[model samples]
Target: MAKSDTDIPAGARRRLLALAQERGASLAGLSELLGRNPSYLQQFIRKGSPRKLEEGDRRTLARFFGVDEGELAEAREKSYGATPPLGAGWVEVPRLDIGASAGPGALPAGEGAFDAFRFSRRWLAEHGLEGARLSAITVEGDSMEPLLNDGDEILVDCTERPFRDGIHVVRLGESLMVKRVASAGGGRLSLLSQNLAYPPVSVDVADVDIIGRVVWKGGRI
Candidate 1:
């Protein structure tokens, strides 16, 4: 008998989500990579479909996640389980399940939800970043190439008010984008990109809201 979606073990779901976050991927993107509908994995996570992942799908996911196929299978057979509690000296920073375009603008369907990722407090302190104002987002385009690649996850410092010269995530009009912003002063700001093909876009500082300044970037590899 196939397991119902509601029967998916909590540990299994957590493991999958952790793997996805580590790889800077979404369930929807992972489903497409496996040649399934974009929503296949999402349904399994949120609604439980196909009862159990087919052997091929399971194998592919296991390899991509750098885990043994048996591990995933084990998760399916087990019941919901408790996760390890975070140890002292570790701080969890919110990584929003949202994509920020480094190239063209993107209009997210809805606001993002944050699922915190634990980091070493020492490491964060060394970098001079406050975990309170830190949030993460996935890069979706190539405009900020060389620095931020597609699929790379970036941490934005929401408390870094007073924009200056740096790469920033901003919401211009209805579209949100990540770009290299330079202050033109006099109430104007310039959005630049590493890719010369994009040219430069200038806008009034008031017209575009600064989301945050990007402080860190990471990718699966």
Candidate 2:
């Protein structure tokens, strides 16, 4: 018998569990990435607690998996190779093998190339983003919590240079880092953390290289 709409999400939940495993991530990791308690996804999956995800959470999961948002509910592979098509406005941006830290210090640059991430061109334009100057990087540590959590993948607009006050990826010496950047009135910049326990870092603008502004972020959830 076909499942009723009210019962559809159980199968979806089961599929999501499998998807997480295929991605080599855990329920706890997905929950934390969505800014939910560690057991949030566990409860939802094991108990069918929510039945359906909130709209925002659904969108997040879709973006993270690089799939159509509706697929999460469909919870099955495309039939007869008849996959849903994306709109013509959709575009993809490259993701580099780079990381930006929300805490202290950073990751050394590695081989910087990967398949690009797909997004709607209209959505990018809405956010003042240009695909040519954009790339995705991972965020490490929890210092940017309540904003950008650890393991979050953020999109950076390399063309959005000549930095102003906002979140940005910056390079100092051999390392690249992510922090809130604000002008210091003397051709200097201050890197601040969302976590109060971490102190602000000051640096001369000329002494460091501003990689790009953090335009967007997505994590598994």
RMSD of each: 14.6, 16.1
After best superposition, candidate 2 residue 106: deviation in angstroms?
1.8
- Give one digit per residue, the lDDT tens place, for model 1 in 26-117: 89999998999998887776655655576567679998988975455434222111112256787666566667887779875544444666
Candidate 1 segments whose C-alpha is farther than 4 A from its true place: 1-87
Per TM-score, the best of the predicted structures is: 1
Count of backbone collisions in candidate 1 = 0
Candidate 2 error regions (>4 Å)? 1-88, 130-132
Question: Which digits, one per residue and each the tens of the lDDT, describe model 2 over residues 59-165?
Answer: 68878877765566533211111212246787666566667778777855463455567788788778776344667778988888879989899887777346578
Give RMSD (Å) of candidate 2 vs. truth.
16.1
Model 2, CA-based lDDT: 0.72
Backbone clashes in model 1, listed as residue pairs:
none
- Candidates in order, TM-scores: namely 0.58, 0.57
